[model samples]
Structures are given as structure tokens and as C-alpha cells.
Target: MTSKVDRPPTYEDALQHPKYEPNQLHPGSVESQPPSYSPGSGMYSSSPPSYWAQAGMWSVPDLPPSGMPTAVPTLSGGLPATNPGEMEGSFSSQWETTSVRHSFIRKVYLILAAQLTVTFSVVAVFTFVDPVKMFVIKYPGIYWASLVVYFMVYCILLCCKEPRRRFPWNLVLLGVFTVALSYMSGTISSYYETKAVLLAMGITAVVCVTVTVFCFQTKVDFTSCGGFLCIASILLVIIGAVTAIVLSFHYVPWLHMVYAAIGAIIYTLFLVYNTQLLIGNRELAISPEDYIYGALSLYIDIVHIFLFVLQISGSATE
Candidate 1:
């Protein structure tokens, strides 16, 4: 052994090495081809191309050929791909929701128009007819009968299933009955008292419109006050009943007038609170039936406020 050192290959010698240009050396020689290399393995000894390098060619791995099985793209672990149909379906669902909301709003406005027409017509007829004297003198029974009928209708609405189905026709009938009875009561009390009723109506209209506009514009939530207001209403009703009974024994007209003024103020507060709920709260998403209920609540508030204001103003005129 002479212990001679082995020399390093020159660049030209390295270029001609068997490992260099393996594909070219094995061109058209299938038997001399290099073994297949896995990604990330050191066997290839070269960096992979940038993903953007193959701009037009198929980038997804293991995708089937176009003519064979349909190719589906997925994330790692193979979840199904998002398709155009799914996107379209989502959009359609959103549109349907919006349409339903618009339809609900339209129905509410239609019903509100009908109610206002009925109410205003009744009030106008009563103003002209002036039947209170005849009702009071000849048909004293009418007052009690009207009260009974109103109570029955209230009960029916509270007890019935699908109360909305009966609402339209029942409201029409009630409007007619109420207008007749109210006309009789107002006229018999005094024809001059009609001016008081008109004044009350004007005040109520102004207050309702103003508060409703404020509620709609501000969009402030007032549902939290609902429970307190309801409790206050019950207490007011009880107090009113007791006071009426006591006043009837004493025949104190002035005390009755004072109560009327107080009642009007309470009812106006109710209108403000209820309007806030309708325009401000998410509970407004309730069905048309609920909208009717809300309208009825506000209607009661307005009507009571008007009656009390009329009674107080009439007493002042007397």
C-alpha cells in the first residue's frame, strides 16, 4: 500500500457523473430510470418549484383526469368542496327572509288603515247623530247592555284560539256598537259636551302622532317598563272602581272630574310606552296576530285618554 491520497473530481468530471442529468442519461432507456422520490425526502437533492410556477396547469394533487372520475377539491383530510349551488342557495334563503319581513310590515299597515277608518267614521257619525238623550230617557237598559257586550267581546278575545280569525269582523261590530252607545251618552249628557269630546280627540291625536314619531325616529327600547306600567294600570283600575263607587254615594261631581283628568294622564303614559315597544324592540318580530294585539292595546289607551279628557273638560264647561 503506497497510501496515495484520492483526488477530488473537477467540475467537468462532476458534470459527467452518472448521478448528474439522470433523466437525460436514461432518455428512451426505461430500464435505467431513477427510482421515484417522495416529497420532502432527501433523495431528490433539489428544491421543489414554487406553487405559483404552474399557473395554468392543474395544481391539486391526485385529482382525476377530466374524462375519467370527476375531480373534487378538498382541504387536508378531504372535506367536500364548496360549490356554486350552495352559495346560490344561501343567497336565496336570505332573500326569502327579507321578503317575509316586508310582507309582515305591509299587512300591519293595511290592518292599521282599516282600524283607523272604522274608528274615525264611528266618531264622525256620533258627532252628527246626537242620540244620547233618547237612549238615556227611553232606553236606560242600553248602557248596561253595551257594557255587557263589550265585556263579552273582551272575554272572547282572551279565551279563543286563533283570536285573529275573529278580529276583523268583531272589531267592525264593536266599532258600530261603541259609536252608537257613545253618541247616546254624549248627547244625553248635553249637546254642548260634544265640543269637549272633540277637544279630547284632538289632544289624543296630537299626542299619539308626536310620541309615535319620536319612538320611530329614536328607536329606544321601552319594553323594560312594561311590567311596571301594567302593575300601575291594575292599581289605577282598582282605585278608579273604588272611587267611582264612593263618589256615586256622595254624588261629588268635582271629584269625578278630578279622577278623569288623572286617568287621561295615566293612559297617555301607556300610549308612549307601548309605541316605544312597537318601534324599538326586537319583540316587534311577533306575528300579525301579535301586531293586532299591540294595536288594540294602543287603541284602548287612546280611547280611554279621550274619554277622560272629555269628562274633565265637560265638567269645567258646566
Candidate 2:
């Protein structure tokens, strides 16, 4: 009798045959293949086909273990493996903050430039033009009246409904304030000789530009001395009042020069302080929302600086 040889079970035969489970023991299979299914097999022993069974046992080839990393669970919206939004959110927040800060600074400087231009133009017109000069000189009280109007308009803008304070209203209030300030500045400039006014303006420009450049370049923060500046400003105001009273009694030339010198120094310091406030990245950073306030602060500083320079130059000529 001829012996019948059983070829190693093919994968197709393994799939079709009920006795060829991957986990079961089979006598003719390779060591990696599980035994054939039998009556004694446990009901829970079913699993995926073994490598040796999937390939015919003798035909199974050697392969190196896979080097690729397993897939990591992703976030919703197709974001990366980590919480994902945290990094993007942080970057966007920083970009927005930087953009707002720069915009605020630009708006403040532009408004200040407009205010200065208006002041200079009004002063020039009133000083040089006969009709304007005559009108301003005839009604000196116009300056004081404009000041009152300015205060009222400013207060209304500050205290009124949000809608009233927006758009054309905010712009109108600012324009009114600027016009009032220009009138007052023009009236004051008329008191000085034309040459003295021009010289004072040039000097003021040089000093203001120099200090502004210094503030931008230097690491030294002038805002740190806020308390000192406040106290000094108060003392200067008292000194100015006293000086005014002394001048009313009798004009002391040396005292006038001293007063002008002191005023210039104080206002220069104020310029430094306010520029620091505008540009500094501190805890008390000027809010982008407060562009009007920022412009107001800088405008006051420059105007005072110009006034003191005029006083000094006018007194020098005398």
C-alpha cells in the first residue's frame, strides 16, 4: 500500500475548515501555528489567524519588526495629537495684543501732531493777520470763555451715553477742544514778539524731539517717578501762582527769568514722563481703548513745553 502525504494546510483550507482554528493544536503544523480545533477546545479560545497559518507554515518568510510608530489619537476638527488649540490660541492672543498696542500708539501720535499743527496755524494766523489779531486782542476774555466751553464739552463727552460718545460725537468733541486750545494758544503767542515766538518754537521743537528720541532709545523708565513728578507739578503750580502775584505787584526781571527757566525744566521732565507712559510696557500700560486720553496727555505735555519755551525766549529778548 502507498503512503498518502498530507501537504501543509493552505490558508484557504484553514479558512474553510472548521477544525483549523488559529489557537487550536494541529499535529502536522509548524511550531508557531496553534493546534487544530477539537472537541476539547475551550469556547473562548478563538482569535485571529497566526502568521504561520496565514502563510503556509513551511512557506512563512522572516521579516524584521515594524519600525513605524503607532498612530496617536487626534483632537476633533483634525487638530494635532495634543490638546492643540492651546498653542494656537496663545499665539493669536499675543499677536492681537501687539497689534492693538501699536495701533493705539500710532493714533495717539497722529492726534498729537494734528493738535500741534492746529495750534501753530492758529497762532500764526492770529499773530500775522490784522483782523484775527484785532478780534483776539479786543476780546481777550474769548480765551477764558473758550476754556469754559472746552471744559463743558469735555465733561459731556466723558459723562454722556456710550452712543453719544462714539463716532462723529467723539470727533466733534475733540475738534471743539482743539479749536479752543488753538484760540488760547494764538492769544498767548500774540503777546510775544514774532521773532521771539519763532525762536521759542524752534527751541521747543528741538528739545521735544530730542527728549522723545531719548525716551524711545533709553532703557531708563521715567514713569517710575510718577509720585515725584506729581508732587513736583503741584509745587511748580504754587510757584507759578506766587510768581504771577509777584509780577502783578512789580516786574522783577531776574525772578521772571528764573520762573521761565524753572517752568521749562519742569515741563521737559513732564514730556519725558508722559512719553514713558505712552511707550512703556508696564503694568500701567495705556489701554488701546483710551486713545483719546493718550492723545490728551501728550497734547498737554507738548503745549506746556511750548508755553515755557516761549516765556523763556520772550524774556531773553527783553
The residue-by-residue lDDT of candidate 2 on 85-184, one tens digit each, is: 8879988999988888888789889988998999899989977887888888888889899889877876765566552337776667778888987887
- Give all TM-scores, in the order shown: 0.65, 0.71
**Maximum-TM-score candidate:** 2
Query: What local distance difference test score does each model get?
Result: 0.59, 0.75
lDDT per residue as tens, model 1, 1-318: 422344333444434686543334324555433323333442432222334222322223455423345656656477555678998999999888767655655555565556556555555555656563444546657656766775666565445536534767656644554454454344333443567767766877887788778766775566667787788789888879988899878967778887887788788878777666544344443443455555555666766776777787777777
**What lDDT does candidate 2 reach at residue 19?**
61
> Candidate 1: global Cα-lDDT?
0.59
Each prediction's RMSD over C-alphas, in Å, is 8.2, 8.4
Root-mean-square deviation of candidate 1: 8.2
